[model samples]
Target: MARYILDHSTRPDPLLAELAAETAAATGESAEMQISADQGTFLTMVTQLVAPRVAVEVGTFTGYSSVCIARGLSGGTLHCFDVSEEWTSIARRYWHKAGLADRVTLTLGPAQDTLSAFDQPIDLAFLDADKPGYPAYYELLVGKLRPGGLLMVDNTLWTGHVADPDRHDASTVRMREFNDLVAEDPRVTVVILPLADGLTMIRKNPDLS
Candidate 1:
């Protein structure tokens, strides 16, 4: 199914393909952390649609996903938060190579601290961080998100283990709990898409008083 979708979807451009190649060669197994080509395509499409003025991404991972989001911005800025200077240094090079240096900013630190310091109203956000930190990141992201703003969360399904009763792992349990929390929260409406791993689309209620 994933193969079929990737086959049908618009493919990444040459520059993006180059970044993917470098990431793979340089990072080895860690390159798997980069968003898949299809997922990157989706991020670009969503960003174009939302046209957010203030975009935030919590996990940069060598800049594949950040590149996708930054490419979609018409005139907005993307603020990326991550804890790895080593990896993000590569991302910086790519962002410069992609001519996106002007539109993107980076802060290297624990996202829990960096994100909490961000005061601007988020028009859109992408969360892909340590699983244990999702709850905290969600709160900060949603709290700063303008009513009706959108937040996309990656890996909420834990490779479909969240639904398999027989597969009880710590990560799966935490993801299930987080999904439940999002589903029950009245402030936002959410739906989990079976994208790579899983992508959860959450929108803060526009009708909130």
Candidate 2:
């Protein structure tokens, strides 16, 4: 651990702001990408219980979500894939300050290539990458995740765009398609939660493993 691991509660912890400050300073960007308190809590709870040894995060942004996942798992490594060195560098600094830098591996490049290169089985994964990439990410992750592994995706609701047939933005359209695909994906058990944005959590059935 390189820095303090902020305690995660049902509500947002005050320390989250302090961590965000470090991330913001490093990236020179606003904290718009940070996960909301509710979503953070959900991620923390899942990680703590699942205790995944190998976790993967797509679309790390400034690393807010990665930090949350790291704090939840008592002792496991999170491999974060993102294309922004500027932002991930900021995330790395905060992770170092939080004493969690050692537990997190930041990989810079296209997420698909990085994920495809992963040879080890993944125990848990968080997807918050490009919207159109969701279905592909899911297809890749489902095979990589071991039995009982958890896959939690952020922004599945796309700010309620899926319900509106009128919004035909590329991202929204892709999300709608992915939503339908996941619903029919019999290989895993899925649940959609209306947390900040929206999170679609899937637990891969044991048979798939």
In terms of lDDT, the best-performing candidate is: 1
lDDT (Cα, tens digit) per residue for candidate 2, span 1-209: 21222333455555567766765665464565677766776787889999999999999987778888988877789999999987787678768877787889988898788889998899999998877788888999998999889899988888999899899988788889999999999889999987777899999999733
* Weakest ten-residue segment in model 1 by summed lDDT: 200-209
Badly placed stretches (over 4 Å) of model 2 are: 1-9, 21-31
Candidate 1 residue lDDT tens string, 1-209: 87899999999999899989999998999888888899999999999999999999999989999999999999999999999998899899989999999999999999999998998999999999888999999999999999899999999888899999998778889999999999999999899999998999999999645
Would you estimate the TM-scores of all the predictions? 0.97, 0.87
The alpha-carbon deviation from the true structure for residue 31 of candidate 2, after best TM-score superposition, in angstroms, is 4.1
lDDT against the true structure, each candidate:
0.94, 0.83
Candidate 1 regions with alpha-carbon error over 4 angstroms: none
**TM-score for candidate 1, residues paired by index:** 0.97
Error of 2 at 199 (Å): 0.2
